[model samples]
Structure formats: C-alpha cells, structure tokens
Target chain A: MSTSLYPLASLPQIEKTPSREDGIPDGLEEELRAYGCKLIHEAGILLKQNQVAVATAQILFQRFWFVTSMKQFGIGDIGMGALYLASKLEECPIRIRDLINIYDLLLQRKAHIRAQAMASRLASTSAHPRTEFKYTPMSYFGNTFYELKDALVVAEMQILKRLGFNLTVVLPYNTLVNYLRVLGLTSREDVCTKAWGYLNDALQTPVYALYSVPTIVCAAILLTTRHLGIGLPSAPENCWWELFDAEWEDLWNVCGYIMRLYRERTSEDHTRVMGMVAKKGVRQWLEEHRPAGGEGH
Target chain B: MSDSAGPSTPSRKRSRWDIEDEEAQLEQAQQPVKRRSKTKSAKTSPAPEQTRSSAAVEPQRTTAVYKRPPHSIFVPPRTLHPPLMPSRSVYCYERLNSIEEGSYGVVFRARDKETGDIVALKKLKLDEEKNGFPITALREINSLMVCKHENVVGIREVVVGDTLTQVFIVMDFIEHDLKTLLTTMPAPFLQSEIKTLMMQLLSAVAHCHERWILHRDLKTSNLLMNNRGTIKVADFGLARRYGDPVGVGGLTQLVVTLWYRAPEILLGGSTYSTAIDMWSVGCIFAELLLKEPLFQAKGEIELLSMIFKLLGPPTTHSWPDYHTLPLAKSITLPPPQPPQLRQKFQYITAAGIDLMSRLLTYDPEMRISAVDALKHPYFSESPLPKHPDLFSSFPSAAAGEKRRKPYESPPAPVRAADYNLLTDFDP
Candidate 1:
C-alpha cells in the first residue's frame, strides 16, 4: 500500500522588518555567505562530473545538517563524502574512481601535488581499485553486484528514515540556475545569485524540505533579474505578488539578510524601491496608516 | 479603484500586484538586523571554559574568512583546525604550551607543583556547560576514584575548592587515544596487538565491574595509551554504577556511541546492567579485528536493523520485561536471522570472531560478563605476557621514587606468541 507522506513543516512565520531594527548580529550574514561559497565550491567540483555518488554525497551533507549538530562534521566536509557513500547505495550509483578524482581536484587547488599523491596512494587499495576506497564498508554491504544493489537500497531507505523522511519536495539549486540560463542571464557568474543564496538559506532554516516552494519561486525571480542587470522585475500585473504574499512574507523573513545582500550586490537599495516593490508596498501601507503609529495597541 | 466594487476582493488582491509600490514598502522592511536576542544569561553563563577556548582560538589560528556572530555555537567556520591547546595551562599548571583535548576534558603535560616530575594532568570538563556531568560521568569519576588497577586510567585527585568554579578532576594524562594509535599503524593491527588490547580492556572492565561500576562507553576513542603500549580506558563520561536506578530518563542509550550501541539499547531496552557495556566491548573487539566499525549504521534505525540482522530479533523470551519499557513498543523489529559472522568477517580468526559474537548477544543475560569474558580462552594463548613492572616506570606509578626520568622511547610491541602463552595457561 502506498503511504501518504507528510511534508516537513516549515518553521513558524516571522514578519520581515524595516529600518534594520531587528538587530541582525553583525557578521552573521558574512559568515553565512562564506558558508554558501564553500558549499558551492564543494558541490561544483562534484557536479562537474554529474556523478550520482558525488551529488548524493553533497545532498547527504545537506540533509545531515537538518538534524544533528553540523559543527562536529567540519561544518560539512566529511558529510560530503558520506553523501557519496549513500549515493553509491542508492540507484544513482557513481564510480568511486570519479569520486576520488573529483575529491583530488577539489583539494588540488590548495593541496600540494605530494599531498595529492599520498591521498591517491591511500585511495588505490580498494577492492574496486579503479573506483573504491580502502575503508568503505562495501564488503559488509556485498561482494556480488546484486548484493551491492540490495545494500544500496537498504542504505537509501535507512538514510531517508534517519533524516526523518524529509524528502519528496526537493530544492534544486542547479535547476534554479538552469532557469536563470533560460532567462538569458547565463553569462554572469552571479546569475540567480539570490536564488542560490535563498536555496542555501532554506537548508539551514527549520522548514528546509517543507514550505519552500514559494520561497524558491520568489528567490528565482529576484536572483534572475538581479543578474540580468535590469534589476528586480517591476512587480508583475494581476497582483501575482499579493497571490504569494503570505509565502513571500515568509521568504522575506527567513531570507531578509539574503535579500539585503542581493540588494547590496545589485546596486539598488530595497528601501528606495519599496514604493515600486508591490510586496513591500503592502507592508508599508499597513505600517504608515495603522493607529498608534503602527506600534501595537 | 476596485475598493467600492462588489465581489472585488479577488480584484483588489490582483490590483495589489499591479501597483508595485504596494509591495515595495514590504520589501523595505525585509532587513534582518533588528531581531531581538533570544539568549538567556542563565543558559549562557557558566559555560565550560573549554568551549570558550575553542571559540576564542578560532580567529587566532586560521585566516578565517567568516566572522561568525559570537552567539549560536552551532556554526563553525570553513577550514577550521581542531582547536590546539597548549600543553600547560596559562593558569595553575604553568610549564607546558601544547595540550590536547580529550572526550571528557583537556589534558596537559605539566610539572606537578610539589613534585618537579612532569605528568599529564587531565582536567575533567564536568561543569554544567558539559550538561552538568551526566550520571555516566559521575560513575566514571566516583568509580575510578576507588579503582587502583594498573590497566585503568588513574584518577589522581578530585580538585575541589569552595565553589563549582574551583573544581577540576585531575587524572594521569596519557599521550593518545587508541584511535590515534591505530591511525599511526602502517597496516591493520597484528593479532598480537589486538590480543594485547583485549587483555587490557578486559582487565580494566573487569576491575570496574568488580567495584560495581561499568565502563559504558568502551571504544577506541575512549581508550588511551602512552607512546609505550600501556592501554587505559580514558573517558568515563558514560561510565555508570551498575545497580543504580535510572537516575534520569534518556540516559541508558547515551553510554555507548552509535556504532558501539548494544542490541538491547538499540531494541529500546532501558534500565540495563553491566552487560550493556559488554556489548560495547564486543563492538570494539570486532572493530579492532576488522580495522573499522563492525555493524556500521547510518543512524539509529539502521543501526538497530544491523544489530537485529546480525544477532537475530530480540524477543521477550530472550529479553524478559523488554516490552514494558516506554520506547520498546515504538521499535518494530524484523524477523530473526541467524547471525552470519564468519561469512562477513572472513579475515578475523575463528576464535576471535567467536568471542566477539558472544559478547554482542542480543540478550544481556546471554551476553558475556566482563569477568567471565576476560577469562575466555582468547587471551590464554599467543604472545607472552610482559610483567606489570615494565609499566612501573609509568610516571604516575613511580611517583614515590626519586623522580625517575620519564621513558622517552616508544612502548615495547606485543607479538603473536602472547596468544600461545594464554593457551598454555588454559587447561
């Protein structure tokens, strides 16, 4: 019997603020941005091969952070490799050889050739010398191809269960970038920058695997236009902005820092455009005309 | 324009988007800097000093492209070096400059104030910041305080002043954990070394069991040795008194690590006895034999499945009263499968594998006790036993003699014949 899977709930909605009054601790934005960059570098190296193992590893690291403390796992380095292992168990298997090569390439930028040689030497003693590693629990998982496949299935199911089964809805960062490409913004390295930023921010927020569809859409819109150099699109007609006001407000709350960064990167102040941005206009109207100077009665 | 029109609510929502300025005000209010602080001083104050050190040391040690807000210790900067502590404290133990943090606390190689001899002073981090030293930690400290075994990590003194700030449990600090030792080995441990470790672990656990204490978290990370081959179980954070009532909920499963978690605990069996620790010994044995975790699980669910798959399903007949526990009903186990150890661990010796399986039984009643397990024939054969006197020169052991200079050379290696001697000593 097919079971109806429940979507993971997003964290409680928090309204966005004006005037920077909420006190974003100084430097928290920069820290998260830096974290975003490292994650991109790591994911980019794996995605270049389009290998399932690498992708799974990257995603697994992302998922692990949703539960347990991420501080202990190098903020997600080892977690990347673990995702690769999980991917190997999933039907989306990639060659271990490709994993090591990508891992080497990722490190090669900063690692000396000698260090690469040592890491490579350690990498070579696996059963599948061309692809596997010395310590992979492959033998425990299987010797035969069929057994390997079965083990992968087991590992996938376990990982899903372990992660609280927060799947079904996925936030595809790469897909949003592709959308930017379709929008004629491919030349810029910064295309859909806010989208990627929002996607990453969504991962850390409590509602990661759930309640993120609208956030994703708004981010895609903001990031695409920011990179297109036309700036954020003037609010669309038919009040599409209001149709998504609730979700947009949720997005704005979780992604206030990211939106600010987008504004900072694009050379347009959000406040200067508040009169033009429909979503912000509604909040401004409410704040200005409300009794008691809009402070709660 | 549609405000006075009937059935215009949808139209108003649509027009709201037409006028971009309406949403613009909302966008202007989107800055994140104004959030009020959620931190309570009661929770923030009295955090363990080690945590503070790890935080402060980050900016000094690396280029640190990320400047994190001082709150929310959850996020670490990319490319962080594990905090490197000086061997001597800036305060009391002031002769060393490089100490390493361990599972329970920090240890520094320092000279004793009264005695000029250099000793490793392990200051246990048991403050409230460390969740106020869980019951397991108390057992480790209280139990080790009474233990005089040579194989055990020795507790020198419980340094207590008038206040909680002044308390620090001092121990004889060793150089490295077994995890560190195995990392340095060129290959997997030779059988002799494995046997030696088994003997040492059994001796210590047996010592603890005799004194009504259990070394709950027995793993390579918890076992430390000096450059010499003397093995001592280090962290007592999870060690607990065997007969003590469940002092707190959610603690029985906290003793052993995920990989080393016993079947009973995995099956949601709580309110355990010393056998819970024997299960950890079983895991360590297999890990030592295989050079990795034996029943490796991605997390708790799979870990339990791996256990049940290897040890067969646990039934009330096997584990009496297991179903009565609060979480037992929550676990839905698969049908029994005869554990197939030999097929999996082909490299391990038949005898060695037998001992491991026995120690890892699903039923605590069926699991081998530390004392009886130590008496198992495994240790009777192989490499010969070295006299305990060889470790007499251990600085802590020799505290009485005219400060005999500490041994700088590496500890002597154990050979396979040590197993032969065990067999000869056996029937």
Candidate 2:
C-alpha cells in the first residue's frame, strides 16, 4: 500500500562489457563520460523547450547510462528515448514522432559540424556528408545516418532491460514544494526561487543516485537558506528539516555531489580524471595479461 | 572460491553476502593482477541459468567499481547508480488461477507465499510492445498512489518475474466487479440500494476530480465492489490530470469506452473536463435502473441518435456553441424531437428525471457536478440511500469469494454475425 516503493533493489544491474579485447580506449571512454553529461543536459533543455516535465527526463537520462555504457549505444538516441520514456511515465505524452523528428534534426546538425571539420582537415576525402535540406524519417535512417531511428527504438528496449523495468522514479521537486509549503515558506518568494534553482542544479548530479528524495530536498533547503543567511531552528524534527527523516550527513553529501558536478564540468579535470583516479589493481591486471590492451588506440 | 560457483549453479541461489565474504578473502590474498583477472573472467560469464537465481550482485562492492579494463567495450563503471536492493520476485507468489484482464495486462488471483494473503497479481503485456514498460501501468500506479480514498482501488506493490520485462502489479483481490453483480443478482437493485451504489461511485469520481484527475474509463466493468457494498474505481489506463480545457498542456482526444463516452466527445469536441465522467455516471445510473444500457448503439451515429431519440436533439438554444462543433457541418443529425423521459423509463421519479436531465444535458457546461449531484432532491424525495453496511449484496464474505462462472459480456444482437450466403453476404 505504500506508494514509495523502489522495485529495483531486488534486481541489481550487472556491468556489461562486450568483450575485454574491444574495451573502449581511455580517451574515448573519458570523452563519452563528458558526452553523457553534455547529452543529458541537452536532453534537459529539450524537455523544457518542448513543454515536457524536466524532472522525469533528467532522472531518466541519469538512470539510462548506468545500465549500459556509451560504447554499446548512441548516447543521443538513448537520451531521446529516455526523454520519451519519461514523458510517458509522467503521464504527459509527447508524440513519438515529435521526439524522433527532434533527434533527426540534432543528428543533421551534428552532421553539419562533422562536414565542416572534414572540409578543414581533408582536401581529397571522398565520403562527403549528405547535405539534405531537412531530415525526414526516411532520410534519417538513410546513408550516413546508419539507421539511427531503428537504433533508438532498439536502445530504448535495451535500456529498460538494464533497468529491470523499474520505472517508479520519485522526484524531489514535488516533495520539496510540499515541504516548503509545510515550512510556511510560500510567502518567501525569494527563498523559494533560490531553493528551486538549487534543486534544478542538483538534478544534474548523482545526488539522486546516492540519496533519497527526502535527503535531496533537505539538502536543497539547507543550501538555499545558507545562501540567504537565514537563521534556522538548527534542530532535528523542527521547522525546516523536521518534516524529513533524512540524515544531515546525507543532505551534505547531496550538496557536495552537486558542487563536484559543477567543478568537474567547468574545470580542466575533465580529460585527466581517469588517469588521475585510483583505478586500483583491476586495470593493472588487464594491461599486463590482455593482448588487446595497447592496440586499443 | 570463485571456482566453486560453477556454470550450473545460479548466482541467484548463491547469496551476494557469501560472495562478498569470499571475494574479500580472495582480494586479501594480494596476488598479482592475474589472480584478480581470473576472478573477473569467472564473473564475466555468470552462466545461462534462467530459473531461480537471485542474481542481485552489486558490482559496486567488486573491483568493477569504476574499473575500466581498456580491453572491453562493454565494461560499465561500478559507480553507476546502485540498483534497488533486489527483492524476492513474483516467483514467490503462487498463482491460483487467471482472473479477468483489464487494460493492457492479464490479472491472476494469487496467494503470497510469505504471508498467505490472497492478492490479485496483474501481469503486464511486454512482448509485441516496442515501448518498454506500458505507460498505462505507470499511470495506474501514479493515480493509485495519490488517490488513496477508500473508494479507490489501491495497488499493493509491483513485482517483477525472473526477468524485469515480466512485471506484475499486485492489488487487493476484490471478488466481484459491478458487471458480475449486475448479472448474478436475481432481482434488480432496490431504489435505496441503487442510491447507495451511485453515492459511492460519485464519491470516488469526486475524489479523483478534486485532485484534477479524470477517470476517463468509467463503466460497470471497471467498477469493483466487495461484499460490503463498497465501490472502488479500478481501471485508470485512460485517466489523466487535466487543467483548464484551453490550457497550454494539450489533452488527447481519444479516451473512454464508447458506450460511456460523453456526447461532446462523440460530437468531435476536443477539450473535456470532469463533465465527461458525469455523463458516464448518468448512463450508469440509467443502466442500474433498467438493468441494461440506456443507449446501446453499434456506432457513433447510432449512439447519438439514441441520445437524440430519448432526450431530444441539441438545439441552438440548448448548446450555443453547437454551430462551431466539428460534427455540426460534417454529420447531418436528425431534427430535434420532444423529450420522452416519462414514457421510456416509467419507473424513475420526477426528481430522478430532473437529475438525469441535468447529468445527460447536451451542453457539458450545464452538466451536474459530482458535488452538486449528491445533494439532489432525488435522494431526499422518498427513500434515502441505504447505509453501506445495510446494502450488502452477498450473504457472507465467503459466499462472495465463491467462484461463479467466468464473466461473459452481454451479446450485441445488432453486431452479432448472422452469416448466410444469401441473407448476410448477398452478392
């Protein structure tokens, strides 16, 4: 009877590596990580622009890449599929055609960027990108498009399988709004708007992945109130944090994760992150014995 | 230790806790990376055991954590969101027999092995659907989550089979739907009994509408009743949260079973409110009174004519916006006829007729709101609605649970095939 149930706890997601021999190169893997972040952000923008609820779409994007790596699928198609799935789950269905059309347009634009780069880099390359006026469903699957529309359909299914069809994703936005109302912050428009902004930024991080909705909401409130220099009751089960049963440490972790996301995206730590981290013992094992190691480039 | 977890034995059977302890001991050996890779290769292929493995292995605890072996394209980071702690699946529930299916899933009456409680297990249709999990199933969960009124059927929990694709939404097992009661009851419902059922239906609808949600599909089949005469609104596959009719969030024109659909919907009107549901309630009220459908037409045109025949056709005076309606120019309906409430259903009272008229009005704007309909003079006129405790239809709860024949929908004589070479398919 409890509405707040996460069914996926019983169905743990196993990491799928196609083959150790064909493992992604370090540069490409790092690029895909950055690409995953960029693609989900773009997906967030697309959902907002198209009037689809942004929370579900953002959550779906974050959950999708966790199931499968970018090496096995196109991030664009998967992100679009994630958005489409979110729209449906949220009970605000955008036409599937509308989503497919948007994806096709993005593909066309990416093609244009590639064409310019190719023209600048190679004078005599024969495989010139197709310069279609507009992308139709037919043209999208044709030529260099390489049947991406079909891939989107297929990848969506694969993503769901990886998720184990655990579609019940709870958002902190609703809980935050209710908590704000309960905390009597409705009249405080400035504070409410600031908290709303923090929540949006928090959506882009693993704050949701690591913490529960209550923790994320409490984290947003804490960050917002601290920025405004507002005095708080500073006690558990009081006016602000009392409504939630979340740990103060988890709330701080939620804030910390968002801060890390910001730092990772803007700083030069983007490319060097993989080599810099303590990958520990596992990669060393693969490099020494696996024949496919150095030839990955 | 990884050697003993052979291809034949399912890791699902092998508890993750056991593996964790063993894996910890293996890693503590401090052997070269080769020893670890050997373990990695062992895990990479977890055998093809399809049945009864609780493969709830958390890769986060393993070296798979952010460990990208440059050799494999498929190896994912272990830091990826930890999946929900895998729970025991639907395999635990012993399915007794198939109950009737509604919406996109087939439901079964099952017993929870752990609790021994009888519950309705709904298995959603997965194959042939390119879309992953059905949206209707999600909406049902969403609606049931928010609308916790006693009159609304609650979803107990969702369980997945051995595979994630095979999901089952478990709900409290109600023995009888309204359709079953309507057919099985020997005599027609008493006036007070009818009022009781109507009040419960309206209460549930009002609860949904108050939350800005519409139960798009509201027919006798979708309404479930326990022996206690409590009506729970069941299917929400077509239901949605609606704002103002002209609001920026557009609504799909397609919804509701045709028999219970409102006139505005059938006449090609796009936007709808709770009025459509009220109209269905009116149809249901009439059916409760007569023990059959008020308007059982084969098609849209025929259904509208049935409405026109009884209530009289819509005039410019009745619906000022009739001219702008999409069906106004396309379909030439028959001219208006005088209302015939008294002769058609002679049993209903004058107050009942007035309430019926208000509910079945051609203009949706004039339709009786659920809140207002409950306070109508019909209930106050003679026999007040009997208390729910007194309106029990079954002799006992056990009697209600006793399986009768499988429910069969009333045959449509008009649409029934009367195939004959000369008579039906004449050349």
Go through the candidates in order and give the C-alpha RMSD of each one to the true structure: 26.0, 15.2
User: Please, what are the lDDT tens digits per residue for candidate 2 over residues B1-427?
Assistant: 2343343233322232243455434433322322332343334333312111212222223323322112111211112223543234787799888877655889888899999988888887877665545676667766775566888887776677775467787888876778767876778889998888888888888888886778889988888888787888887778876765432466666877888888888877777789999999999898898888788888888888888888888898887777786777876768768888878779888998998889898888889999999888988877888888886555323223553446967777654455443375675
- Highest DockQ against the true fold, candidate: 2
Question: What DockQ does candidate 1 score?
Answer: 0.03
The clash numbers for all candidates, in the given order, read: 59, 20
Q: Judge candidate 2 against the unseen true structure and give its global Cα lDDT, from 0 to 1.
A: 0.63
* lDDT string, candidate 1, A1-297, tens digits: 111122432122122211112222223323332342354346545555334333334444444433332222233234334444434332233454344444444433322433444455666753422323232222323443343333333333333333432232234555555455555666666655655655654443333332334444554555445445655333322223223332333333334433433333321222222221122333443355455644553
| lDDT (Cα, tens digit) per residue for candidate 2, span A110-162 | 55554555564565565766454555454544553445545655656555555
Q: How high is the DockQ of candidate 2?
A: 0.11
Task: Give the per-residue Cα lDDT of candidate 2 at A223.
Answer: 80
